[model samples]
Target: MVFKCQEDSFLKQFKTTIVSCDFATLDWVADDDNRNNGETRQLRGFNVICEDTILFPEGGGQPCDYGTINGHQVRSVQRKGSTAVHFVESPGSFEEGSEVQQQLDWSRRLDHMQQHSGQHLITALFDREFKYDTTSWNLGQSVSHIQLSTPHLISRESLDLIERQANDLIREGREVSVVLVDPATALEFQDARAPRGLPKDHEGLARVVRIAGIESNMCCGTHVTNLSQLQCIKLLYAEKVKTNVHVHFVVGERALRKLGEVFQREQQLTAALKGGASQHLELVQKLQQNVKSTRKSFQLLLKDFATAEAERLEELPKAQRPKYFALHRRDGIEVDFINTLLRNAPEDILYFLTVSEGVAAGSSAKGHMVLRGDPAVVQEMGPKFLELLEGKGNGKENNFQGKINNLAKIEECTALLEAHYKPKKAATAVEPASAS
Candidate 1:
């Protein structure tokens, strides 16, 4: 059904009589693009059907219009058969046959108009120049993209050409008009592209949007009256996904906003890199190289430290050595340190070693641990050690290894290890004292 929005397209406010009001529920789902951790929710309101409305219901790849009815906020509108249903989120109900004031969010309406019209211009230019049919398109919150029915990636030069042509036509200020034609006579217009045929509920006439000297296409979304209203167009990039190529672009104010954002990001990079925009890339690459060199030197130092620690343990007299030893590192997640220490140390002493990511101990800090000793002891201590560190792992008989997350519980784990190997005194017989 043709809507009042399609008829005028620029109407901001209108007085329309309410035809019916019924209790309804709208299931609102979070859009993947702008999701803010909001789950799907049910919105309760009255479905107020109006005699006529300026608010456009969502269809043809365009989102629904947000507006108000009698100063009550209406976040959603939908088309049911041939009627427009306005979901009014008001505690009070509207009387049927009473007049109500409907207001449009002008900024939102204008943005949609510019983008929808801009898409027609882009689709027409692509089909004319490269013979690429636009299979589908999206009108996003910040940017939009059109899917072309082609497997080959669009080149940078082709993008530049299309962008330039689109802007040139925008400057030409060509008229854009919509006309209702009989469904049987839709083919009378030459070069009209209707990928998705007419809607099933559509009865009388089919609506066709025409751009002068360009092309005519069947559409149901609201649009601008002229190409000049688009201001400008910017083609961002093209990416091939599966069988189709998506060409991303922005129109009018969105183009200006995107430019401002890019420039701001460039300024931030210049300050962080201590260089101009042109030198940012080179400076960052040099910084990365320096880090790589430093990390290698650090690893070598850790290996030397591990060797020194092993030698200290080995030098201790056999009688003076403890049954078990525990070592923990908070500097980094280098399990090789544990490996090196185990390899060089005396084999008799049980070793419990850990390496974590955080410089300071934290409950949520992640790390890895290894337990090496007698086969029986390793099997017995593996589960206890993992339980203390809040991690899951299994190990071979004499060598148990696992990943851990609770670095703050390392002290508790160390105490358990020390107690397990602690000496226990033998009890003396008391039978002789009792006989005396």
Candidate 2:
């Protein structure tokens, strides 16, 4: 609906009467069947229509203004036809015809204005300089982007030029004005960019925004009165998205915040790497090389130790051999180490091998397991081992490999195998009955 925000974009507070209040439920689920089956949750808010409001509803690629009405938090604002609906978060509804004070979250409102206006400035420059038409734009939480009608990516040189030109306009303090013009007379203005046509249901004069000697376009979003209010516009980067080139950017306070965040990250990296910002990449590369060398040496040591352990197990007398041979290695040892060790083992050996990410007492421990032995034995015990560890695996012949989550259950799994293969006590025959 036509409101004070349309006439004065900087209005932060106003008093308005409630025209209507209704209970509304916003369903989050996409499918009706899922909503009916309770698979979807609903957000309940009061849709309170105000007689007049300074709160701008979501439109023209700009987000709605968030604030409070009569001390109750306003979560969302939307426009339905000629009516502005305020979604107020309250357990009870506000009384119709009652006067309520409306307060706009000024910080959020100003941020939207800065970004929206910055987009207009940038769009105009691109169209004038490179003949690139803006197909779409997004005002995001941290950064905004405009999609240009170009299949090729925008180059750094072109972005820098546009950015410099836009900032030049900001520095000049160009006057930004909004005017209402009749549809028939709109074409009389020079270089005026109007929408193809007004919506069939749209009534009244069209509103057009003009920047001094720069651009004139039809827009419904709130904007600053002058270009200087935008502070500065920074084109961060650009990339090719399908058929369009999407340019990411930040404006005003958002640009400053982004700069601060980048500086903080750089400081953190410098401290961690013990190097200056310029030397970070080279230092990181050296650190990576060192890690690779260390890992290679550690792997060789594990292989040699596995080989020695396998030989020691094989040299044990058959009668003294354990029913089951299980090895639990620390985290970072690969499953291939188990394969190497089993290569030296006899076919009769039943081995349970595991590499854990953490100690058994901690729940986060996770790793892989490899079982090797007679096909009949593994076939009988493999499923049980996986079931106890809550794991899944596949096998062919005598070798089975899988990932396990509960490393604490490894000992229990091993005991099951040992008990199954343990030698049974011999039974003696009785001859006393024949003698009697």
Candidate 3:
């Protein structure tokens, strides 16, 4: 069925009757699913079918339109057969055959129109100039990309050419019109770039959207009436994914908004780097080089400190030396420091050493640890130490090492090690004292 949205894309308000309303439940997820932190809600609502609506159902790489029905919020609308099913978020039901007011979200509709029409223009230009067919396209939240059939990568020169031609056509202000023709005669007006056939559930005449002096394509999505409404077009870049190349671009208000955002970021970078935009790259490169040199010097200093610590332990007299030694650093992930210390130290005293990332250990702070000395003690303590740190590792003979995260419990682990190696005193007999 030809939807009202397809008939008149500019229509923002329409009066329609509710054909049916059924109990329904929707599992709604956050719009930014990646950063939602595993949050989801079950939306109890009604599946409302309206006789006619300005709300467009999702189709042709375009998302569904969001709006309201009789003052209740409708978040989703989908096509079921020839009808538009509106998912109204409400516990109350809409009476069947009752009159209702349908409202369209104008900003969303305008944005979709700009993007969809821009895709049509771009597709036509690529087919005309490069003989490359558009296999598919994606209307992204920020930018849109069209998958070109060619395997050869598009160069910067080609991107500039296409972008220039697209804006020129937009400047020309060409008229865009839609025509409904008989299914049998549809092929006569549409160009070779048109889709092969109509949708499976398509009824009545086929709709073909035509750009003046350009091309005609079989499309059901809404679009702008004139090319000038697009404002501008900017072809960003192209990327090759396996077999096809995706050419990314922005259209109309999106291009303007993107420009503003980029300029704002540039101002922030200038303040942080203490340089103008022209010198930002050079300053960043120099900063990176300096950091590299400093890191190398710091690593050498850590090794020297490790060697000195080991030498101090070795200088202790045999009788005066403790059975075990524990050292912890609250600065970094310094496994090399632990290895260097063990290399220069005596093998008799059990050693427990750790280096964590923060000054004060939090539950999430990460670190590395090593236990060395007696093979028997190493094997016994390896698994226990991992369990205490909420980590994992394995050991064979004289050393056990692993990565750990829960550093807040390090004191408890140290106490456990201390109690294990504490010296025992000799027992005394009292029989001679009793006789005296």
Which candidate gets the maximum TM-score versus the true structure?
3
lDDT string for model 3 (1-436, tens) is: 8899999999999999989999998886645523665478788899999998899999888988888998888878898878999999987999998999999989888988999999999999998899988989999878999999889999999989988998998999999999887767656455525554667787887778889999988887899999999999999999998989999999999999999999999999999999999999999999999999997887788798889877977897777676777777765787888889889987778888878875444355778888887898889887888888887777789889898878778777767776776663211111122112
Residue by residue across 338-410, what tens digits does model 1's lDDT show? 8898899999788888888754444567889898988888898899888988988999989998998787777
**Residue-by-residue lDDT tens digits, candidate 2, 39-78:** 6556687999998889998888888888899878786788
Residue pairs in collision within model 1 = none
Clashing pairs in 2: none
lDDT of 1 at 161: 98
TM-score (C-alpha, index-matched) for candidate 3:
0.89
lDDT (C-alpha, whole model) for all candidates? 0.86, 0.81, 0.84
Better of 2 and 3 by lDDT: 3
TM agreement with the true structure for every prediction: 0.86, 0.83, 0.89
The regions of model 3 sitting more than 4 angstroms off are 30-39, 182-185, 189-198, 423-436
Ranking by TM-score: 3, 1, 2
For model 2, give the 10-residue run with minimal summed lDDT. Answer: 426-435
